[model samples]
Target: MPMEDAGAAKVGPDDLQAMRPHSKPNMPSPFGRLLDRATYWDLMIVASATLLVSSTYFWLAPQSQGALFEGRALTFPEAVYLSIVTFTSLGYGDVLPVGFGRVVAVLDVACGLLLTAVLIGKVASERQASLLLLLHTSDTQRRISAFAKELANIRGALSEKSESEATTKSNRAELYSLRTLTQSISNYMSFNGFQAGIVEFGNFSALSALYDELDLAFEVCSRIVHGSGKNSDAVVMARAVSCCTRIYVLVRLMSRLHRSAATRSSLFGTVLISLRLKKPASLTLAEAAAKNKSELLFQSMAIGLGKAEAWKARGYHSLQLERVLAEMPSGSKDGWGNQVHKLIAAKLGISNSVASKCVATLVELGRLPK
Candidate 1:
């Protein structure tokens, strides 16, 4: 018994070896590999199978001298070509199959056509996926570029505010324009009409003016986060404005829900909520259908008052404002400032000398110093 046990327990190295060297290391089988490799060749495989089935039918069919001579009696070359053509259902009909032979040929062609279509559809679907991926990649690059520009603009605005230079009249106008650009958000929200009953935006009421300004400022930043409007130079600020509108609409619509006694999210100071969050649309840019799970997508944006501090506080600085002033009409790098002055004079119905003095007065103020 001991001798028998020892012989049975002996380990054989040969027994552990695989029949083929390419056998898998960890996986149980080649199923996944087959699927991947087969996906691309699906159409070709169908075409080949279609040809095979059609040719096989012709070859095995009751081959007698008369049957062989009839229905454009085919050899290997002709039969293979006919099989392929029939399978694809693109028969030129130069060689026709008649009677019972025609029936078999037609059946072969139909099956081949159906399988070919399925394979072609799959290929089309894959191509669409690839195109979508490319578009998503392009959008991501744009977002990165926009983010960098915003950071630079914010820095410039802050630097101007931190300066020790005297404020000039030109500087005031430049500041006003920058504020106007930032405050354009009210228009986006006006379209939504969330605040129609409670307030009218623009320079309407004394208290309303304050509310209007807030709405505009909030909208501009929101659009920036969401990437609104056309991707044009003049309309670059549209996205930021849209984001602002979305929030105003949300607050007006959800004010009661947020104010509910049991609600967890704070409703107070919710003016900046949309601004504080990233937009849903920007996230959905690549997706026709959402890849993520969420009830409201834009809430992901972080457009809060704190976020505003990063950009808004810089605008309040003096030296930075001076730089911006220098870059404005009189201080513009482009010669267009003079043309703009000429146009302004024309618009105001003023004389050439008056326009010159106005320009000089702006220069005297630190606004034109940039």
Candidate 2:
């Protein structure tokens, strides 16, 4: 088999592994790690403060002067118990402070109220963190499952062609299904949660698997694009376009993940969700059936890839570039190539080399005036 043929090879679940290395669960010092966590630190701080207050009260007032319970002087144990109850606002009222001890008891109660608030806030924050992690993980799992099904269907569609109308309809249906899955991924990944979650928890495996599937999809599309005949061309083009859409969405997602990871998974990025500028098309396959292979390919490059500015700069097919140039007003033809190149570079976040390639393709296509 040729390189492209090899590239188009189907990957089963057994063939894909999550990209990141498996971290051995540290068996030692579980408690130590817990203590190192922020939640643990918060609890310890409040507990130490309570202990300090209890020790101070125990020393300052004798049993008779400091506290009385059922006409008995408070024991050391009883003083500690009072501190716990006061700090928690549990006020059993079984023990009462007397004399100078009353002043210390009142202060302890005030401190307790503040500490209680802090503890509550800290616990809530910890729970929120956990919930965010869960959401990200669940979303990742969902994407992985969806990708598996999509890739399997695409593989089946491209493996053999059928002359029967039923087969053509089925291929078209599969193409649309893949497009739907790709759009879902686009929407999910546009949110910061996906990137942040993967970075923090090292879910690189899922990400790696995603990239593998995307690469395979591209291969499948490539095979179809080169081998498609007039009868199957439309269906093949639709599938190819769906592959491009998936690649584009996945690439953007990977870019965001890298950015988030580079920042060391900051709490701000991980905890706070960012808003998207606009809603993306809910259905990407709406035009798949209408476009021929060449037209579909250009459309995929122009819109399916991403923001025009971004993908144009990264580079699009010369054919797509030709279409773009041909559509420009005749009056704007002079020095238009440089302007388009610069526009692509500036808007698409691509390098000058890529922008130049896009312009070169247009020139090669003779879309530029002599």
Candidate 3:
């Protein structure tokens, strides 16, 4: 369907089918959530400790019959107390284990030492993870600051009239650098560490500002790339647009996770504003549906490829530079092998750059069958 037909659309079976909302998943119980939060290794350590104590108690109960301070068999409770004390290396003189019981106590103590060592290692690992995460957060902040400065320079250069070919070439080169920076930041921000940081530290206000700056940088870069006929490949433009769009989508997703309604709404508004800033050259069914940030533009972009398994496996939450792989399907008759990307951009209300990226991603993921 053409862009006009998609916009002035009619209700059809496909439209009705796509409109059907999915059922929400059942929420986990409080206890279940606690268990889910616990590492399996920690649970195993507790379980093993319990089993070892129980086994040691059973072993000592029968052997310490009439030989200890009590002139009868050591009861299960006494055996249990002994097991615990021995395991902890708390050699209290209350219960004297003679012969085989001494061996049992030694075994328990040794096991206790091993368990203690394991626990210490686990604690060290957790501390190391925390330290590394702190370092990553600091580095991300520095990068954001650097990118903001670079954007400032680019904006200054863009405002000036090109006096010569050299100046024009210089500005274009700077614009290209700006594009690369946007891509680098996009890649950096997509990591799990950044997502975890958003939850651990309630600094959405700062992050929201960063996202806004990024949006500005990307917009300026997009204008430069599209307006300058120096780059004929539309994919370059698509990549910039995709990066900007992905940033908004990821922030929106993160806002949901961090429960920052204000940040989420702000990003949502930014996305809407972004769409209106540059009226796309083409439209499709998918793009037409995306009137607001509440609509999943990037999410729908991933879905439009019809490669859910590949998308999930790669843990891909953002669109990247998949639009303009010159090496991608140049030999194909359909020109890039399929028009799926076109549909994707149209449906998501994004530019050709984003659509190209969607296609490129599918091609790279091996989702498009041979």
Candidate 4:
């Protein structure tokens, strides 16, 4: 086994101990955790409870006798009104607290200030989150649009009968750039906690357009391979394979996210049912459901055309791009043709007979070697 693999496999107590400090540094304090978990409704409930408790003390305490409403003893309703006024720092002056009631009033004012601060902080954070999300969405959409246009230009270049060396070099460079961009976008979508946000914000249309562009890129790759004839440049072929494989991984990642989100929604719905609560309709869920049918169809078609099963047979998992490239046959057109056949078969997940037929069709269409 490789040294890294061996180290990963033999994770002993020492390794865990070494990792502990790294994990503890960012741990939230109890109060911080409470604030993070608290919702607006939770804040409202806490405020209501505080008011009720304070009002009860003012109404029942002997020290509060003849303190409120110009020396008149407070009733429960009058006490509640005083609590609200005090909590808001209104100081209407109609009600006055004397003796021990004065101390309670001071503490109540402090609590009011604290709660107000927390409420302001919460609102500010939410607005900040919304602004960040908007910026991210806009940036992502812009990138995707540029990527699609570049892919289209490359596809156009690939279609021309007369290809200059300079043009070929340019196309290769563009393909490499596109592959890098695809990987970056995939990482962003997968790791940045934005998948739900993407769905919620109705960016499925953008994603759908991206998928379409990737499909065009795949077609462009087939053409490149076909035009290379018997003496294809290994570097160019490798680049093409890298591009296609990355696109495949991206599609699978999306499909997996879609399925996982659906599962989460279903589980959450079940919990709501058991708790006798109405399940709130989620924009993410609604948008996902609306887009699911067409997305699945596109995925199925793309997989069928690409031969997804052949990729699985070759041990090409979503994160194993290096392995896929390492295993690719180098410096031989016949070898690359067979690889392409497998690529199509693996991506589409077709039966062996279907795969063979697809290969034969490609061969007849001059898209692959016989």
lDDT of 1 by residue, 38-109 (tens): 444554655676678677766555553212434446776677766777776788776566556687777787
Q: What's the lDDT for candidate 1?
A: 0.40
Q: Tell me the TM-score of model 3.
A: 0.39
Tens-place lDDT per residue, model 4, 116-201, is 88788888899786787688778777766776677677666553222466765676676667667767767656553222235445
lDDT (Cα atoms) of all candidates against the true structure = 0.40, 0.53, 0.46, 0.58
Give the alpha carbon lDDT tens digit for every residue of 1-370 in model 3: 1232112212222332331223324633444333333454654666477546655554455654312545455666676776777777896867777766667667778877766765565566787867876886676666656766766676566523344657655654655565556546544544432233333333333454554565455455445333423222233333333333443444344434333222222222435445775332332332222222223433443343223223211222232223233223444536544575566556555566655655556556665433
Candidate 3: which stretches are off by over 4 Å?
1-74, 91-143, 155-171, 183-199, 220-370
lDDT of 3 at 147: 60
Choose the strongest candidate by lDDT: 4
lDDT (tens digit, per residue) of candidate 2 on 1-370: 1232222222232311332223334422433323323344555665687667665675457875587788887667777887777666787999887787767777777877765665676566787867877886777767666666677666666543646778656665666666667657655554433323343353455555565565566556555444443335344443554455455545544544454444432222323333333332222232222112223333444353344223222434432343345444354456565466666556555566655665565556565554
Off by over 4 Å in 2: 1-120, 131-139, 159-164, 192-199, 229-231, 265-370
TM-score of 2: 0.39
Give me the overall lDDT of model 2.
Answer: 0.53
- Candidate 1 TM-score, true structure as reference: 0.24
| Order of candidate numbers by lDDT, starting with the best | 4, 2, 3, 1
Scored by TM-score, the top model is: 4
Q: Work out the TM-score per prediction.
A: 0.24, 0.39, 0.39, 0.46
Clashing residue pairs in candidate 3, if any?
238-353, 286-347, 286-348, 287-346, 287-347, 287-348, 287-349, 323-356, 323-357
